[model samples]
Target: MSIHPYIEQAIELLKAMISIPSFSRQEGDVAAMFEDFLKSTGINYYQRKGNNIWIRSKNFSDQLPVVLLNSHIDTVRPSSNWSKDPFSPYEEDGKIFGLGSNDAGASVVALLTVFRLLEEMQQPFNLIYSATAEEEISGDEGVASILEEIGPIDLGIVGEPTQMQMAVAEKGLMVIDGIVKGVSGHAARKEGVNAIYKALPIIEWFKNYRFPLVSDLLGPVKMTVTGIEAGTQHNVIPDECRFMVDVRVNEHYQNKELFHLISQNVNCELKARSFRLNSSFIPTDHPLVKRGETLGLRKFGSPTTSDQARMPFTTIKIGPGDSARSHTADEFICVQEIIEGVNTYYNLLKDLYIYPV
Candidate 1:
């Protein structure tokens, strides 16, 4: 009638992490908690500016390939619909509820446990464990800042809420601001060219525009006109119209290529608000992916973007919990999911080997 040590430790660590409200740019307290845990475990780690902590096994040799295990320690602000306090950890029917319990707390502890287990074995590749910060907001002080210190990472397993499925491809993100200009005059007399009218064609183009290239896994690039503004008063015609476009890009096209496609087709001035989030993909024939296949993890294209998009190296997204449960009113992770996560992670890496072709 006793729980397994891995489950007990993972649950305890997840509870401790969820007890602290580490929202977006504020992960100081949670980092301190992790520092204490690491100290008690007698593990060496490096702390980046925003509380991003990472540790590499002392047993590693530069001659071997390295695999990175990473997950964020931040959460989005809780919504108003929660039944209990967001930061307070609560358990019911084998589930743990809190702000970040599902989004990544489950993955963090699971990976930490896996990292500890792997340290005892002589593996074919080096292993690096990371609990990064500021992932919710795409902040500069998070994973990107710590990679240089960790050195080169040939492959990575970026953890997120995926129900232990393998996210082989993740979509990229881009936002654009569009401007349409015209002369201003009285609206009643129709004495001037209306910027809003000029913008209509551009907006319609965005609604119907489709990039010819389609990814076998991710399908197509999706574009949406999210916002628009024009006209100050009903009595006068507006000289300028402004709008915003949100694009989810597939791996087949880069952000810049999508930008060019938009700019070339639309007859309006355009400015890119963001273009850095690049799509990520791993071929089915990849050794890690093949290993995952043997372990029975389903492959899917993730429409949602994760820290994987920011990684310069190839990465696969797999973890506990449900993506639907993330950023919700009563966010939670099932006890079963956490245990499954530990097993899945272990199975995926247990027989991994990286060699030059």
Candidate 2:
């Protein structure tokens, strides 16, 4: 099928973005390019921190409920195995290849197309578009700060590479740093308690532990003891054994709840590194979700985290490309995927009124 003009425009924009290397915390150059595009396209937007960009429709009304569309502009550094130059954009057999192609550049351009289209028409709710920075690192300067400036938003759509499936829920992430304390002495004499021995049960507990509540879509919260370190020398019993646990949390419990539960059960000093990215979920019966279902969009829980994890309001993650293609060697997205993404985003938002008008 021949591509629509809007899709062509989105493709060109994505190519331009991918041509620039916008690694996490270094999106200034790419953001400036987008700002130039916005000005040339006659779209009104504001820059936050020289990287994050926010645009609201001219029809914006505070009286109406607002729906925010967001996608990240920053990407993880390219992997070493790419046969093609990561910063050089290429097209082959209907695919666009580059460093950030599938991860979020597709979503960013597709959403920009949707925003431009929607800006010309009437809408049931106010619309806001954010091309955010620092998502790959979850930096404080990105969406976390933008939300505070935008005030209340009734609904949100976080654009990620979900292959057009609507993600009803996404897993939250937390890292626990723990230390097992013990007396130190010569290992040959066995005169002190070994911290490694003290850590054994705690590590085992993390390995076998399960949260009581399980999500219908996301399943049980997962915990894994990913790292352990102890002992200064072969002949000395170490006084401290340090370990780290990687936790993938579900919506059944808050991060604090899980952290407290684990800490109380273990004899060691276990503390959460941060709980900023909490699990996110949107109900199946929500109007936007029902509309998506009617349009034949499938729903699933994302094991991978996204900007959706940080939104305070309800959000459904849907966009172009495949998640598996993200942050990998020779990342690419089919031209058809970007076209489908624009259509899907427009279909899910065009007619639905989140609140009775």
Candidate 3:
């Protein structure tokens, strides 16, 4: 089948974005490019704060519900393992290769095209498309920074690499720094209570303990002891052990609740870094999910974190490309994936009905 003009336009825009290095906290160059593109398309009322750019449809109204379609504009720094020039865009076989191409460039442009396609038409809801920065780092200047200015969003679609499958739920991430204190003494004489020894059970608890409830969609909350440090010298018994904990929280519990539960269970002192990215889930019976089901899209719990974690309102994640390819060497998205992504986003939103909050 022949490609639509909007799809062609999105493809060319994505290629231009791939050629620029828009790393987290440093997306000025590419954000400028995106601004120029948006202006060229005759979009009049977009807003830019830091590197985040967003625009509402012409028919925006507070009475109607809003559907937010968001994708990140930033890419992770190119890995050392890259065989091709990460800044140079190239097409091979059926794929377009470069940094950020698959992880989100395809989704960014495709969703923007979908917005353009629908902006002039009447619908039951309002539409907003955002290409934000710092998503790879989950920085404050990303989507989390602009939620208030856009007005209240009834629901959201976070565009990550999910191969066009729907992520009805996504895990939230929390990191905790902990310390285990013990008596210190000479190591050779065995005169001290070793802090590292005391830390073993804590690590085991993280590995073996399971939460009380399991989500049918998201399964169990997961925790891992990722790093540990104890001794400063070879012959000295360290008085304190420091460790890092990585938690993947499900929708069943808030991050603060899990942190409190973990603290009560362990002997060590644990402090959560932050609890901003709470787990996100939208019911399978939601109108958007029901429409997606009719279109034969598969729905599953996403183990990977996305900007969906940052949104406070109801949300689902679905987009082009594969999450496995994100942050890998020589990242690329199939040309066909962009074509299908635009069509899929358009079809999913064009006729779907939503109840306003």
Please give, for residues 1-357, the per-residue lDDT of candidate 2 as tens digits: 687777887899899999999998899999999988888777756556558899888988878899999999999998789999989999999899999999899999999889888878888888889999889988888888788788799999999999999999998999999999999999889599898988998899899988789998899999988898998889998989999989999988778888888878998887888988889999899999999899999999999888877888898888999999988999999998998899989888896799798
Give the deviation of candidate 1 from the true structure as CA RMSD: 1.4
Q: Once all C-alphas are superposed, what RMSD does model 3 give against the true structure?
A: 1.4
- Using all chains and alpha carbons, the TM-scores for the candidates as numbered come to 0.97, 0.98, 0.97
Ten-residue segment with the worst summed lDDT in candidate 1? 41-50
* Top candidate by lDDT: 3
Best by TM-score: 2
> In model 2, how large is the Cα lDDT of residue 271?
83
Worst 10 residues of 2 by lDDT: 41-50
Q: What is the lDDT of residue 340 in candidate 2?
A: 85
Model 1: per-residue Cα lDDT over 281-321, one tens digit each: 98888998888888888999999988887788889999999
For model 1, state the Cα shift of residue 88 in Å.
1.6
lDDT of 3 by residue, 168-202 (tens): 99988999999999888998896989999999999
